[model samples]
Target: MGYDLERFVGYVNEGLLCCVCRDVLEDPLQAPCEHAFCSSCIHGWLVHHNTCPEDRLPLDITHLRPLFRYMRNDLARLQVRCVFRPQGCEVICALESVHRHEQQCDYALLNCSNAGCPVQVSRRSLEAHLCVCEYSSRVCSSGCGYTVLNTEEAQHNCVSELRAELDMLRAELDCKVEEVRHEMESRLDSQRRHMVQKESLLRSEVDELKGQLSRVMSDVRILLGAERARRQELERAELEKAELLELLKKEGLRPATPSEAAPPPAEVQRKLSPRSLALDCIKRKNREVTVI
Candidate 1:
C-alpha cells in the first residue's frame, strides 16, 4: 500500500466479476472494513448472512446508495452478452445496448410466465406457440387461434375457443330462423290460395242461386196474372148461365137433357158460379203443389 493515483486510474477499466451472478461489478460498494463489493453481490450475500465475507461486519441493505451517474454511463459502455443468449439468443452487445437488444432479440430464451405453461422457449418461438397454446388464449374475431400480445405475451386469457363456439352457435341459430321464416311463408301462401279458391266457389254458388231466384219470381208473377183473368171469365159465364135458367123457369119448360139442364158456355160446359170459380182456382193451385 502506497498511494498510486495514476495506476489506480488505469486499473479502474479492468472489472471484477461477481462470484454468484458472474456479471461485472454493477455498483461497486464498500464494507465498513474497506472491502469492495458489487451492490447486487452484496445484496445476495446479505439475504442469507448479515456479515460481510471479508470483514464479518453487520450489513444492511438500506445503507446502499445510488451509483454516480458518470460511473454508470462508463460501465454501460463495456461489452456484455445478450442477457438470455444461452437459451437461444445469438446477439451480443455493449451494456448500453443490452436493454434495447434484449427487447428485440428474437433468439432470446424465455420462460413461460404462465403458471400453467412453464416450458422454456425462445422469444420468437414463444409467440408462435401461443397461437395454438392451450394454457394462454386471447379473443380472436376470425378463428379460435389465440393471438399473443407482444406487450403481454404471457398474460392472455383463454377465451378464444369459447368465443368461436358462441359464434358458431349464433350462425346455426340464424340458419334455423331463416328456415322457419321460409316454412311460414310457404304455409301462408298455401292458406291464401285455399281461401281464394273457397271464395270463388262461394261466389259461383251465389250466382247460381240468384238466377234460380229470378226465374222463380218471374214464373210466380205470370201465374198470378193468368189466375186473375181466368177468374173474371168464369164469373161472366156463371152470370149468363143464371139468366138462361131463369128464362126456362118463366116459360114453364123443364130441361130434360144434360145440355138443357146446364147451357154450355163458350169456354166450358160446366160454367162456374162466382164462388165456384174462386174455389176451382184454389183447387188447381193445390193440385199443382202436390205435383211439384
Candidate 2:
C-alpha cells in the first residue's frame, strides 16, 4: 500500500483510489469487467493472481485499457499537501502536480554522507547540520595533516600545525633529495662503466686495426720489393740481350741466307772480289761499246 494513501485518506475519494495499492490512482486502468485500478497496482496484483481484485474473474493485463481522460481530470481537480508536510513544507499543489513539487521539495529528508553520522535532516537544513556535525570530516584549510570536523576545525593552531607540517615536509624532502642523489650516482656509475667498456672495446678495435694496417704495410713492402727485383731482372736481361747482339754484330755472326749457305757459283763469287769485280765491270763496258 502507498504511504500517501494512508496520509491522504480523508482527502482522497474512494472512486479515485486503486483497490490494489489503496492509493489515489496515478495512472488508472479499466479492466474488461469495468473495474478500474492504477495500472501499476493491477499489474502487480496480476503477478500472483490472474483474477480481478473486485470480482473473481479471469483477467489479463492485455484486457486492461487506459482511463487517462477521467483520471487526469479527477487528478487535476484534487488538491494535495507536499509529501514533506510534516518536515515543515507548507506548500500545497494539485494531485497531478504533487510529484513534481515533491521532487524539488527542500524539506525532503537527506541522509548524511559521513558513514559515522547516522542523522538525517531536511535538504534545506543539511548544510547547517553538516557544519556542526561531529562525524563530518573535512580537510584542514591551514594545510595540516589531520582531517577534522567543522566544529573542531576553528580550534586548530596554525602555528603548531605549520611547524609539524614543515618538519614532515623537511624529512620528506631530505628523503627525496637522498633518493635523487642515489639515483644520479647510480646512473653516473652505470654510465661510467658503460663508457669504460666502450673505451676498452674501441682500444681493442684500434689495436686490431693497427695490426691489420701493419700487415697491409708489410705486404705492400713485399710487393714493392718483388716488383723492383722483377724490374731489375728484366733490365739485366735486356742489357745482356743488347750485349749479345753487339757481340754478334762485331763477330759478323748473322743468320745465314740461302745463298750464303749454298755459296754462290765460283765465277760469281770471284767476280764479287774487289779486283775481279772491277775487271768484269770494264769488260762489260767494252762489250757494250763493241755492240754499239
Candidate 3:
C-alpha cells in the first residue's frame, strides 16, 4: 500500500502517486511503459489482470522494475509525518527517515510483553502496565525456581510442582540406567558367544592333534615289532651256527669247501637209494647251519 498523501508535510509530485492506489508511491515499481505504481498495488492488480492498471497496456510482473533513480531521489526527499502522529507523535522527517522514526516513536503501539496477554499499549506505558498486568510472569518466591503468572500466583503450589519435576527427573534417570544395563548385558552375551566359538575351535584342533598322534604311535609300534622280529631271526640263526659248529667239532668232521658242497648231478641224485638220500639230506642241513 502507498503512503497516505495527507501524511506528507508538503506537496508530493503527481508522478510519485501510485496509479492503482492514488496515494504517494511506496516501494515504487515501474512498468516497461514508464508507468509507476506501488509494488504491492501492482502485484495485487496483476493477480487479476496481466495488463498495466493505468493504460491497460500488455504488462506482467516480469516487466516491472525498480523506480528510476531520479524518481526515487525525489520520492525520498519528500517530507512525511510520523505514522503514530494520531497517537501524539508530531515528528516530521524525510520519507526515507520516517520508518526509522516510527520504529522508536513513543506513540507506537506494542503488545503486552506477558504471555497470553491481550492488551496493546504504547511503548511509553508498557512498563507501567507490566507492573500491574495479571498475566505478567514472576519467579516463585517459594524457592522452587519456577515462574508463575501473577493471576495464578495465589493458586500455585510450589511443593507439588517441584515434586512433579523431581519425579520426571527420576523417571529419566531410571530409563538411562535401564538402557546402560541392557547394553552391558548385550555386550556380555556377544562375548560369551565368541568365547564358546573360540573354545570349540580349540577343542577341535586338540582332537585333531590327538588323532594324528594316535596314528603315528600305531605306525611306530608296527615298525618296532617288525624290527624286533628281524633281530630275533638273526639271533636264532647265530645260535644255530654255534650249535652246528659244536656238533662238527664233537664228530671230528671238517667244514666242506664251497666247491665240495655243490649238489651231485641230477641223474646221480635220481638213482640214489633211500639210505643214500637220507645221508645227503643230513649233510645239506649241516652245510646250511655252517653257512649261518
TM-score of each: 0.33, 0.52, 0.58
**Which digits, one per residue and each the tens of the lDDT, describe model 2 over residues 170-231?**
99999999999999999999999999999999999999999999999999999999999999
Q: Is candidate 1 or candidate 3 better by lDDT?
A: 3
For residue 110, give model 2's deviation from the true position in Å: 5.1
Q: Over the stretch 1-292, how does candidate 1's per-residue lDDT look in tens digits?
A: 1111221112334324333344455566655554446776777788998776665777677665555566667666666666565566656556667779888788767777665676777877987777655566444544546665444555545575567778999999999999999999999999999999999999999999999999999999999999999998787767765754564344344324334333334564364556466544544454344334
List the candidate 3 regions with Cα displacement exceeding 4 Å. 1-11, 17-24, 27-67, 85-92, 115-118, 156-161, 197-209, 216-292
Ranking by lDDT: 3, 2, 1
Worst 10 residues of 3 by lDDT: 243-252
lDDT of 3 by residue, 233-263 (tens): 7876666556545645643465556754577
- For the record, the alpha-carbon RMSD of candidate 3 to the native fold, in angstroms, is 8.7
Clashing pairs in 3: none
Better structure of 2 and 3 per TM-score: 3
User: Worst 10-residue stretch by lDDT in candidate 1?
Assistant: 1-10
Q: Which parts of model 1 have CA positions greater than 4 angstroms off?
A: 1-15, 18-23, 32-34, 44-51, 55-73, 110-120, 131-292
